[model samples]
Target: MKVRALAGVALLTTMTLTGSPATAGAPTTAAPAHPTAPQQATGLRAVADRAGLRIGTAVDMNALADDAPYRAAVAREFSTVTAENVMKWESTEPQRGVHDWAAADRLIDFARANRQKVRGHTLVWHNQNPAWVNERDLTPAQLRAVLRQHIIDEVTHFKGRVWHWDVVNEVFNDDGTWRDTIWLRNLGQGYVADAFRWAHQADPQAKLFLNDYNNEGVSAKSDAYYALVKQLKAAGVPVHGYGVQGHLAVQYGVPGDTLTNLRRFERLGLQTAFTEVDVRMPLPADPIKVQAQAQGFTALLQACLLADRCVSYTLWGFTDRYSWVPGVFDGEGSATPLDENLTPKPAYAALRDTLAIAAR
Candidate 1:
């Protein structure tokens, strides 16, 4: 899951409840000063529990296997997990019929062992696609068949294990037009509906979602999703959710009217989630920028809490050490609630405070 800002467009993009006090080790500068004994919630999972939402993070097989602390942190903090890439098209079916399930199976096994729900990262996406999919110029009918089969096989494989599936991801451009990916180029916009249908057929119990970034706010991208979701519901498409990837940057400022946008989707009888949230700042993160990042993080959680149908809040990854921001966005890192050393940052405290207040 390399989270990049939507290209060729600029777009702008939480909760409170109380529980036990947050743990110590949070940066004093980032943490709020307490008058009495500093009472803080235990962890994100605890905070989310107070607000009736699930807290999750993306995980990779390597991290689970190699990093003891990472695995412990994930198990301790999150109640749900999304595979960063194991379930993506490129990783699942690089050779078309020759499907691979090793990595995905490991993730599922780990989640089961840890008592965490699993969210299948994606069933369809333009990026990280296998070359074989495009290199062989198949007819519209052939490509459609291929797409349908892929969804059916993948969803069926994970069937009862997955709680949600990102049935289609990043399909719309920032300006509300469909991205001319292989799916759109060959199967047209019809592929979106078809993808959701196929996934639902394979596993009716699993929630199906259309996930994307740049739609966190009330913008053209979100408007496009709103119209698409309405049309899908009218046509009896089994679309279950809309995933607003909360990938923010302090420099760009938090998105406006996010709660309103999420509520509109909920009105369509669809569940909503902060699918992939991370607030990145430029390198050598100073107090001012870090504080701003904390504010941005708290705002997202607050918006989710305000939305009735927003069921889950998932960070892209929990710790900065494994964040995809630095690799993708030069000079930008520290995008998660935990720092590289797995220490809670100000954003973590802010989240705890927000959830605590919301619970009250």
Candidate 2:
């Protein structure tokens, strides 16, 4: 959360086809006119139009904040933007004493002006905390209060704007054990409950999502989330969706059991979204490896498209230029399907092609 583009970076920054349209050229001043009726085939938008799907691109808030050209670049690739990093507690309230809403504000503003729907980054995550929220040695009760107030201030701060907020993030680890987050330590399990309640009070319309990475396949983490969601639903928490952050690796391959995991959650009547979707190839962009990675993207897209309640599918960030992979992954972070300067990579074209075929 709070993914910032290093200022002065050339700026920001796509793939896969389950039915995504092709963004073939540079995003232009004029959007093309739409056909009155649905086509058998076309690009990402077309696929969505015919099938009623949501295709989105994640973007950096700072890119939209002070940089016009960068903003234009992003506005070109995506019609829907998930504030890539902004909106988290750390970025918004880095110095605890001060509340810096300007960044998140601009992102929300950009999405609104563009007629783009936004997925609010997060509300309760152990990472990206304001220094002051936990700086002092507060007791469990005091910490609980901090958590509640944080949910209120943050949720109310952008009420009615964002369509969905990742209310709680990565609470379960790969092993199905609860992550040792400060929220867990101080506020106990009830914090998750209270976050949803406070968020509901702040903006009843905004859908609340429990977001996590690497839950694409049925694993311990997915099981843990599944159990927690059942409990939350039984307890009347306002959780409406699941954010399957698609940070998958090409080596492992998308598991066969993911469909089962997805179906189980949908049975609970919750919408699912492929939140931070990106499948990374192992290394030096070999053509073969790239092809496998492209296939991986196709697999992920297919999963989302087929899942009954999967509402949307979004690539984490569009191009290699702006991806967090290089910053986070050591070997070579060429997981993205778009190249620098935002050209349509093979992955992008392949997805568009898939969408076209589906429409037909």
Candidate 3:
């Protein structure tokens, strides 16, 4: 019995170290499979199936069209997909009244082919509004009409295709106050409920969500959402989900109370999702940072797993090759489960192992 136990311990250690650091931009060989980590061969979507969780990743349209490997990885790895930019207001309607659904349509079709559900990113956001939408030229009444029309038209176009619509995005600040935007400046706080109503009217079946970052834990931001959900539910608003953008940095440790925060919203009769998760670290990554990043990714996944109503956990992007972090954040990058060469990092192993254990 002692010898058998020692053999099992040796096997576990080998599997754990299999995904350890390799030379930058070079593919690291996949770890040898074991009973607990089946995802190396089965892919995340397969393991996630047993657990009834929607494993997803944000899809970059340009990369999807241009890179064969990227396209394959997206189809094989995720059971749900969100357009990284194509579904946003500016991309969908760059020129006033001239909507371009080519890119967005292609994405939807891809998701359909892969049997993946689509998450319509946002119907309303202060940033990424088209050039024609503004307070400088249009009156408040005109702005309100335009906002309503935008929500209705967009939702109507994608009606049955979208699984969830982020009806409003980043409407609150860190301190739990409303952020100033064209919608707020012209329409007032009631615009939120109005947006939800407009979306529900267009697609009564699609779930509507309020999405934001920095609300993974019970902070002032989440408190504002909690209050808003209660008010919306009280008034019979169509809000159905709470979206936590799980963007974590190694410098700032993962929140310990994420599961607690998720449960509070779940109790309100709303499905919850980690909509945009990625764990970034400083450049010139080392073994310590790699391990820490894995923990950060699994931390969010574990919370979603434990919460009864947490339906999905989606990565912002799954590969460092096309990650948005380095372009946006000056000094930090490597914010994905896979390296630039499409090698699975330790984070990938961690997520797979967590899902495997949960399945059992």
Identify the leading candidate in terms of lDDT.
3
**Count of clashes, each model:** 25, 12, 0
Model 2 misses residue 1 by how many Å?
32
* Per-model TM-score on C-alpha atoms: 0.87, 0.84, 0.89
Q: How many backbone clashes does candidate 2 have?
A: 12
Model 2 gets an lDDT of 0.69
After superposition, which runs of candidate 3 have C-alpha atoms over 4 Å from their true positions? 1-41
Cα error, residue 143 of model 2, in Å, equals 1.4
Candidate 2 lowest-lDDT run of ten: 19-28
Model 3, residue 46: displacement in angstroms? 0.4
Report the C-alpha displacement of residue 254, candidate 1, in angstroms. Answer: 0.9
Q: Please state every model's RMSD to the true fold in angstroms.
A: 10.0, 9.5, 8.7
Task: Score candidate 3 by TM-score against the native.
Answer: 0.89
